[model samples]
Target: MEHYLPSFHLKGKLAAVTGATRGIGKAIASAFAEAGADVLLISRTDSDLKEMKEELQQYGTNIYTVSGDVQHYDEIIEKIEQKKIESSIDIWVNNAGINIRSAAEDVTEEEWEQIISTNMKGAFFLTQYAARQMKEKGYGKIINISSVAGHVALRTGVVYAMTKAALIQMTKTLALEWGNHGIRINAIGPWYFPTTLTEKLLQDEEYVKDIVSRTPLRRIGKLPELAGTAVFLASEASDYITGQTIFVDGGMTIYGF
Candidate 1:
């Protein structure tokens, strides 16, 4: 057989991304659009969703925004269904997650519940709905935005770590269960990346130095790098890969300082 490069384009594909107005989620959403996929952005804030839609539309791909929360996947799915856009989804990103930093001793039941509900529970349920749609289509891609904290021990709040760890396991289990259906599920485990949420921490010289010292790359991750990883997983280039977590951590997971 003649050799040919595998495709990385997402042209004519329909994708959905949760918590997609900022940070890692936004980067993936924008990348999907740039790769020629029509995107449906999911978020709790209507204003943010609207703003992102406008930004993504410039890519010349269809940009749809659904104002909803992952905590209620059924309702959010219903909202998308009403718009008659749910069935056509080809890529679904479970990126709606949250973290609460608190000492283990000071962790509250409310905080634990909130983090668990949003990160693990919501993602699982959303994956269920997205998988259902993909099952009907006979093939699809699901990318979970996990974290380096999931695979290693860190000072990241225990509850947040718990949720991220669960996501890694969830990715494996779901891939095993769904692979026969032509759906591939994988995750991206990212380390420190400059985002609105971590703007202050990244600006602190001491913290930056500490982070750089620990990472083999000696630098923070760029948003496009993470986005590019997402694009690969979302495209046919990654069709044969599943149940895997690719760390976009700048080697932070390897160095223990």
Candidate 2:
């Protein structure tokens, strides 16, 4: 039997995923490892990182864990240098983000700054650092974990929405500037998911119902469901795609109620 595939295999590749201690980021890192890439996991919690590393090791892929806040560029860069990963990072997933929900009028400057710093500033700087490495190597994949809030305003809050919107634009601009260098940049915008960040919302039956009613899929997305898209972007299957945002929102973006 002859099998012809697009070579989705990630053997010998290296992937770095931020906020990989749990939730969607963890799922993406696990998926990348299962697909054959050595994974570098990053998060702020050392204990969580250790546990996640232990769990991911069962996949038989090399795993490295770094504990640091992405908002601190120097620390993140130092950690990356310290790891001295054997292979050049083929995929960089900027999945670390924070959300502070407040009414537009009640949002404080500090709250706004925190949201922007974590979701936009940190993501930009991390991508800049990763893209530099990728540019030198002449090939790389950068996937920013954005949200449906990037496209449409959510009742979740204005500060969070603003940062997400900025991320989408940043993804596009970076893609345009770095595409010639063979560094592809794209974003995945997820809808409601039952992750640590959204656990509160999920507990609210009415809120959950409203979200489901609005979404064509009629259910919240699962963390693992995002893994395939992450792998696709990191693999040769998406070599031709760049400067785009894939909405993994189960048709929520297109649904108008």
Candidate 3:
């Protein structure tokens, strides 16, 4: 094996991915399984989790499911502790999040609270819990699923952007605080992926056209394309990397036009 090539292999490792039912989260879970990690899938729907476990079983990785709402931090922590049993949670992916697209002034208080609670508060606490476990074992990987909206004003939604930007900062801060303890923290900022969250927006021809024209790659992101970055972050290949937000957008962040 070369210097870092073998670091990409995740054989015998254990990973837990939140929001593992569909879209980016599911794709990331599948990727980790493909990389030979036993995965714990966490989602809100138990039925969906069951189906996902069936689908991911073929990857030859042990699949476990924990169902709960991420917004309910205590409930999620309890479920995770119960399901985790004696396994060391080596990798934790905070992929559970919500977005409410509204103008800054038009955004309701209720919507603001929902977005903040799930996107920011829930993920932060879960990361805290995961870090404590990781600290005990002396090593872990934490990957937070942020958004490109955090980097620049994409006009998606003001509050959504706020939460994501906070995630990026959180990644950096956690990495700084935990680096000596062997816990690595990083973030992924995706742009214009065709997930359930973007189903309605993808239907508008004008919106599609705008996305293509603005993106240097001129194509919306594919679900699988977003998985490799996550796999890399979760694996030992990223041992030297932390506190960085890798934007998985197709040149959207770098484009000047």
Candidate 4:
């Protein structure tokens, strides 16, 4: 291993990733483990969490998991303390989120609250908690999984976009507020990826074509492709980078049409 491969050596690091039971979160968690970090998986379902923990255990990395909703701050805090990982989370990833699709006019107040509760409020409080621990330890990495929808609107509607945009700003603000304490906060804005949540959209040929046309790469991203960004952000490779949202969107954000 060369020094240039800083992201490849995360040994001795401990990471906690939310929504690690599936899709992008799962990929990121597995990648972090492969890069030599002990990983703690968090999600709402215990079965899924256990399954993922077992799967990741096959990689020979230490895996811990907890089941809880990110919406309740007290519950999250309690879970963290109960797990005895309160001050041990070196890389905290706020990857759990939800998207409700509807036209702006058809969007319900309930829907807006759901998205905000998980995507914005949950992320904010969790990051705040992690930042406090990191400040005391003199180091930490915080990665928020946003979306290109944060920078560009999609037919998915306003609430999803709003929460993601808020996440991007939250990352920037936390990065600035915690930088002096050696805490680096960054975000990853992904485009289309094959996941249970996006399976319906991927099935529509016309919609798929439209997305491909807009993306310079002419295809949706793979889960693994997004993992490297998480690894880099979590490791020493990105020590100098903070308050930035790296768009892993195949150039979708830069396209006007």
lDDT of 2 by residue, 129-198 (tens): 8888899999999999999998987887877887888888998898889989999999999998778999
Off by over 4 Å in 1: none
- Model 2 global lDDT (CA atoms, 0 to 1): 0.89
Per-residue lDDT of model 3, residues 143-230, tens digit only? 9999999999888999999999999999999999999999999999999898899999999999999998988899999988999999
Q: TM-score of each candidate? A: 0.97, 0.97, 0.97, 0.96
Q: Which stretches of model 3 miss by more than 4 angstroms? A: 1-4
Is 1 or 4 the stronger prediction by TM-score? 1
The candidate scoring highest on lDDT is: 3
Whichever of 3 and 4 has more lDDT, that candidate is 3
> Candidate 1, after superposition: displacement of residue 22 in Å?
0.7
lDDT of each: 0.91, 0.89, 0.92, 0.89
Q: Could you tell me the lDDT of residue 182 within candidate 3? A: 97
Pairs with steric clashes in candidate 2: none
lDDT of 1 by residue, 1-257 (tens): 98678999999999999999999899999999999999999999999998899898889988988888788888898899888863488999989888788999999999998999999898998889889888987899999888988999988899999899999999999999999999999999999998886788788999999988999998999999999999999999999999999999999887855
